[model samples]
Target chain A: MSSDVKRLSLILLFSPFALWIVLLILLPHIGMVALSLREKVAPRVYEFGFGNYIDFINEPIYWNTLLRTGSMSLLVTALALLIGFPVAYYIAKIAGKRSRGALFLMCLIPLWVSDLIRAFGWILLLRETGVISSFLIWTGMTDHGIEFLYNDVTVIIGLVYTVILFMIVPLVSTLDGMGDDMIEAGYNLGGNSLTVLRRIIIPYAMPGIVAGCIVVFMLTAGSYLTPILLGGKNSSWFTEQIYDQFITRFNWESGAAFGFLLLAFTSFVVWLGLRLSGQSLTNTVART
Target chain B: MARANTSKALLFGYQAYIVAFFVFLAAPLVAAGTFAFNDSLFPSLPWQGFTLDWFFNDTEPKLGMFHDRRLLRGLYYSFVIALMVSTLSVAVGTTNAFLFVRREFPYKNFFYILMIVPLVIPGVILGISILVLASNVANTADDRFGIELEFLRPGLFLVVLGQFSFITTITSLVITARLRKCDLSLEEAAYNLGAGRARVLFTITLPFLRPAMIASGIVAFLVSFENFNTTLFLVGSESPLTITMYDRMAKVGSTPVLNAVSFFLMVGSGLLALISVVVQRPAPSE
Candidate 1:
């Protein structure tokens, strides 16, 4: 009797959570796919077909937007890699115990902010008479105030500012577990530092590097707020197009197709990341 | 030894660059926090005279900068919704964390992978799903059950549900990461000490898990509070604080008060994280 009661109680606890996920997370994704195939008419009837995919393909702006978004994602991913690798190395390799926690907290602060507010700050920084321009004028970098906002350059910088932490956390955690012994051995064997890095450090952190790149890519690709706020109308990205289709034009079909394609793309990147590392994100980083 | 010295020089040089890079990475938050007290509303050129008026403008008659009624309301709603979602996520997350950590179950990998799909899936799709499902269920409830469930409407409860969908996965991941190293020997010791199974878990193990639980809970809260993509879809015009701010910004680009609000929020989140870090009890590791 006690066993049955415990079983009943456990089921009661687990079922609601499971049901919530199935209904919200799993089933809704199914609905997105369904919504993609279904054509919405005047009186709330969705006629189901492959018309949406066809329309999506027929749209050049959509493909162009996807390409632009993809490249933007790549740009940010590359910059974050260029920017994050050494910091992770330093934190994992050099920082004292007392300061490491504080350093980690610094990496996390920007991450915890609202992306909207973060983007707004970029707008505030990059605008025609904004912070960067004012600084330029003060330092006499330019004869007149400069306008940096609403361009690809600002968008790239904004995306980098937002998504860099996704790169750092994984990289630092991965690198932290790897000791200095191998590098020391390499040096002992008369290999130079550059040689050691290219030959050993890169390979050691490859999994984390790959996982971090994938995460940064997915975030930059799926990002709407940064590009929307900073990218301006001329700086059109795929997510911006998706937003237009759904909210402005009231079209769900093409929007769903666009959304699904983005999903498939990110899923492919994640799968590729898993394949690259042959491990989960946790282990890929510094082998914790 | 000479080779080590040469390599050490090189690594230190690289570390110098890294220190600079970290400073660059941390610039924005510090900048935003700095300008929160700026007398100037905009981030214009020339360090506009600094003042604490932005923090104290709540008293003026014609739009007190500091005492923004709308902004404060939004912040309050954000806190409430975040707290609710965090609690919900932690509750569910703890269950899944327990399941994954403690015992072998049927199709364990399947359930594990199945549970974390939302983590990788775009928040955009996740948002759409919650919107459709909640509305559909609400529709059916009104039709069949003759009960209009306002809580399930596109508001607080629905927002919590949407945020919790993915937030639980994060909380679960963090807790599970800690749980794998929870040293089941402790539980075994408790079991041997004339304690019941529940007693062993609650008395012996739960304290050990508290730090992770608290950290994950607070993180889940922050994620929900800042969440925009999902909330955008499900918020139904008057949803929560972030939604309200977004709507205003989207329509009219909002006021400088928003900057004040954002600054305050960033400070609030920073303090929460700092306190969490400090209050975190050091659990003896395995």
Candidate 2:
């Protein structure tokens, strides 16, 4: 092909993808950033200012909810890590070949369903007249059906349950690469199980751990459905605040500001997680 | 001897833990699936006689979910949106994968990373951003060019756009992974044989990419069909299956029909998951 034709073909092939990235991803974020800076001055008028961000800083309710959401997300990440690590270890290291595939499949299947359906499953199991409450009552554990839904505890459980697979998938892949001989070698060398786990296993899995934690933290922090459905009125999830601002109040400026704040907050948390875990973001994301 | 016994005990304990974990993971799904046949109006216990009323009932008192117009409409909308989004995503994603993997350009790494940002961004935030951006564009066009883009208004088109914006990234990544493993020699040999660039692409490159394209297309469709967070903000009047399901669960007390929906989804996705595992399974000799 001639150079001009080659160049033209390159542009032709590249423009759509380039336009997609620029128009859809980059421009919208730029729009959001611009929207975040402005404040509504009058009807149908928006003026550039930091007033929207200032409102977030000044309102204790807003920042408090953000902090609460962040902390709750942290808790969920930790719990998912706790529950997921052992299962991942079992599947990756201990299970026989056939059982390994089956176990992994069992973990993978739940993730295929929508988060809404998964949250609904939790509601069916935890509601006032739901299965767990009914089981407790029938077993004489309670006099009447207990309302187990619509609490922070329920929200945390739902969040952990929802994101645990994210944690496990990474951990399993990471652990699957680890050799059992290492563990056996550590035992033979008189290292206790805990010592080996702390020194060898944990270090080897740090990339996976960081990746899983980042994903779980981000998902939990920004999650709207599980918190709203399972936590009900008390669920002060920050994404709900963003939703309320955008959809409910029609305050695009405030919503844009909150959206940026969430992006910043989650990004910072992820960076901090990587820093603490001594994992590079590129490596962690690659593992994921 | 003592160490061996202790390790054996630990193995047993870990085995029990795994069993308990599976139970924890599976119990909620089992509970939900159970109510699909419960014949009870509510999804909760007190098992009414086992019946398929939720799946097939046509009468007024307890019409099956499939017989419900609103739900069927939602399902129709979901499928249509999924179809559009998957087609668009696959086309864009396949092209981008070729560009990223085969061709080099300035700021390629930067654009690649930028594309990945959408994947990690919360779907709710992504929806809001696109909604804001598209609405602004529509307003600007009306003010300046007097052209009202009806598609920009929240609807199936917007939903498809919202979903495609992020899902394309996933599709591209899938294809890119496959492309990385593909041998480029075959294409080079085709070119050496006097095959034109387009011919080489069609006859060699595309055939090699068919599996990745199909797989990613299926994934894109599934992701779009089940999307709620992004779709919720962008959906103007038409509620997809997920949004409809959420509405029923939240506003109206969900019935066994919802459980029936969940059952069908589980079965469908379960089969897909099984198929994927089987397809991905390594050869026995290997």
Candidate 3:
């Protein structure tokens, strides 16, 4: 193809994608940032300032819920890593080829299901009159029925269950790529199993660990259905606040500000995670 | 001998831990599936007699999910939106994948990072941002052009647009992975044989990408169909199945029919996943 023809074909093939990214993703976010900076004074009157962001700072509930959501998401990420590492190790390193495929599929099935239905599943298991409560009553572990839903513990459980697969898939891929000889070498060098795990295995799996944490943290923080359904009346999830502002209260300015703040906060957390793990964002996403 | 025994014990412990984890992961789904058949009003346990009322009952005091018109309409809308989103996403994503993987352009790194911003951003935020943008566009069109873009109004069209924004990125990533692994020598050979560019692309390149396209299409469909967080903001009067389910669960609490719906969704998605696995399975000789 000639130079002109090559350039024309490139434009023809690429403009639709470029148009999509610029029009949908970039413009909307830019509009949101613009909206976030301005404060609505009356029905149609608006003034450009940091008033929306300042409102968030002045409101204790907003910042408090923000911090709570972040810390809880971090806790969920940690719990998922703790639970996922062993299962990933088994599937990647120990299981036979056929069984490994089956195990991975088993983990993936729940991921494909809707998050709403999964939250409902937890309700069936943990609600006041649900299966576990009944079981506990039958076993004489509790008097009458105990309410297991509508609490922070239930919210954490639901969040972890919802995001565990994100952790496992990445960890499995990373661990699967590792050579078993590395571990054997550590043992040969008089290193105990825990030492080998800490020194050799964890470092080798750092990319996957970082990738999983990023995904889990984002999902847990942004989740709305799981926290609301499982946490019930007293949820106070930050996403719920965003939902209330935009949908319930019809305050798009404040909602947009909260949305931008969430994006900033999650990005910062991801950066900190990558920095602490010594893995770059490009490396982590490429691994995924 | 002592070291071997210790290792054996450790292996046993690991096996037990994996078993427990599997049970924990699966128990909720199993519980939901079982109670779908329970002949009672509540989804929770009371050892009610087994019945299919929730699935097929059309009588008074026992309406099946399938028999409910609203739920059925929600399901229909969900399928329609998912179909449109997947088709659009696949078309745009496939082209973008080729653009990124096959050819280099200026500002490619900048654009690449911008494209991924939607994926990491929260769905709630994405929904609100799109909602704000679309409304702004609608207002502009009405004021300047004296025309109303019906698609920009909150409905299936906006839902498709909102979902397409992020889902296209996912599809592009899947196709890019396949494209990277694909052998380039075949394309070069085809071109060397005097095959036209279009011919080489259709016969050599597209054939190699068919599997990834199909897999990504399935993923895009599922993501759009089950989407609630983003669709909630974009939906006007036409609610998807997820939104309807959320409303019912929150308002009326748990019902047997809800369980039935959950069971059906599980089975449908499970079958789709199984088919994808089967399609991707290696040939027997290999």
Candidate 4:
């Protein structure tokens, strides 16, 4: 086809989906942001004002929950990287080829399960009388099961478990794309493993590290199901508040405001994650 | 230089820890699946005996692991809802792919960002918005038109709609990525050769997108099957398989049956994913 005609055809083909995208998704999100400045009425009515944002900023619960959620997500991301990097490195670089695929697949089995099921399973495993407790008791570590569930431990565990795969896969893909030949090249130059790692491996794996961190971090931060299911009554997370505002309370304006806050928090963290890790948010998004 | 060797030991320790962590992370899931087959009614430990009876067993009150009706109903509902979600998402996604690749409408970047935003938004928020919107619609419709839309009244259709909001984005993104690889010029060439846009799409572009579409479909199904926050608000007295399992784990507090459901889902989805991997063959060389 001729260039002009092709361009014209492209224009023709794209119009409807583009319009739908704009209308359905873009408008709703923009509407959400717009609604954040308003006040809720009897039901669905939005009274235009800055009251919602004022309430949002003034509330200590919002700030504290928001801060804790962000920090928790960050902690989970860091923990996942610490935990997953070696496994990814081993499978991608050091492991024997015959066993590598099997091991990696085994690592991934949990990822395919539903988040709800996993959360429930975690509760069962971590409940004071549950399987994990039983194991602890049997080991004579304590006569009673340790208080693991409905605390910070279970929430952290749940978050880390859910998002760890995100961290590992990106790191694996980046490492595999790089291959391990560079390490040998560094070693041939009389450098030790640490030197090679610092000088060679880290630079190549930077993209993966950044990509993995952002993907996992954002997921953990925005998550509601994990914290709700595992955190129990005392271990409240902010997304639960947001969910309650929208669902049980039937407060749309407040819900919209809260959601907008969540969005901003996510975007800011994503931007920070990219900057700190030295990769673009675009890169991280694609990796996931 | 001497200190650097310590780093190696540390790395080794970290590696060992990771392997242990993998076991830690994965043990519960494996236990859940394994315990499902246990003849004992307990979720953990104390196996009465090895038996396939759980898979085929029936209790008089019908609370037996295999004989539960509500669980079966939930499974049926989940599958139906998943099927609906996958079908809708695939359609929207494929069309969005066509639009993304072939057309150059106004505010393209704006639309692109909008389509991608939901990927980042938590499921909780999305579910909340849909519930708000649907309930409002249902209420207004009842008052104004006196027309009762059962689906809009927080049931299967509501769940499907809620899921479509986010899962559709997943489908579109996957399809869009594949479609980007497919040069738009071919479709134009076919058009220049006098084939209509529909023909060009169905014959050429659709085939290229088939694998991706199938993948998107499977992912959509998986997403919907496990959907919680969104489905929670939208679901009625009946529940999906996951939600049912969740309620049992939370309210009733003790049921080996929940693990049975998990095992069934784990094995089922795992097998489907395995088949997809073998068939899709991610590595082009292999």
Taking all chains together, each candidate's TM-score versus the true structure is 0.91, 0.94, 0.97, 0.86
**Which runs of model 3 end up more than 4 angstroms from their true locations?**
B284-286
Candidate 1 per-residue lDDT, tens place, B1-286, comes to: 9988987898788877867777666565555556665666554445667666766755553244446666667777888889999998888888877777764557767767777666767777676666766666788999999999887777777777888888888888878877887887888788778898778878877877788899888889899999988777677535567777777678866345566667888878888788677656464672
In terms of docking quality, model 2 is: medium
Off by over 4 Å in 1: A1-17, A41-43, A276-288, B1-16, B59-62, B140-148, B251-255, B279-286
What TM-score should be assigned to candidate 2? 0.94
Candidate order, lDDT descending: 3, 2, 4, 1
CAPRI band for model 1 = medium
Q: Each model's DockQ?
A: 0.50, 0.66, 0.76, 0.42
Candidate 4 chain A, run of 10 with poorest lDDT = A16-25
Best by lDDT: 3
Q: Which residue pairs collide in model 3, if any? A: none
Which pairs in model 1 have colliding backbones?
A: A174-A285, A174-A286, A175-A286, B57-B66, B58-B67
Query: What is the Å distance of residue B17 in model 4 from its true position?
Result: 4.3
Model 2, residue A16: displacement in angstroms?
Answer: 3.1
lDDT of 2 at B75: 85
Model 2, B60-111: lDDT tens per residue?
Answer: 6687878988888988998899889989998988888878887878988777
Q: State the lDDT at A54 in candidate 1.
A: 80
Summarize candidate 3's per-residue lDDT along B1-286 as a digit string, tens digits. Answer: 9989999999999999999999999988888888889988888778889999998999756789889888899999999999999999988888888888888899887777666666777888889889999998999999999999878989988899899988887888888888888899998999899999889989999988888888889889988988888898999899999999999987888888888998999999898888877766656974
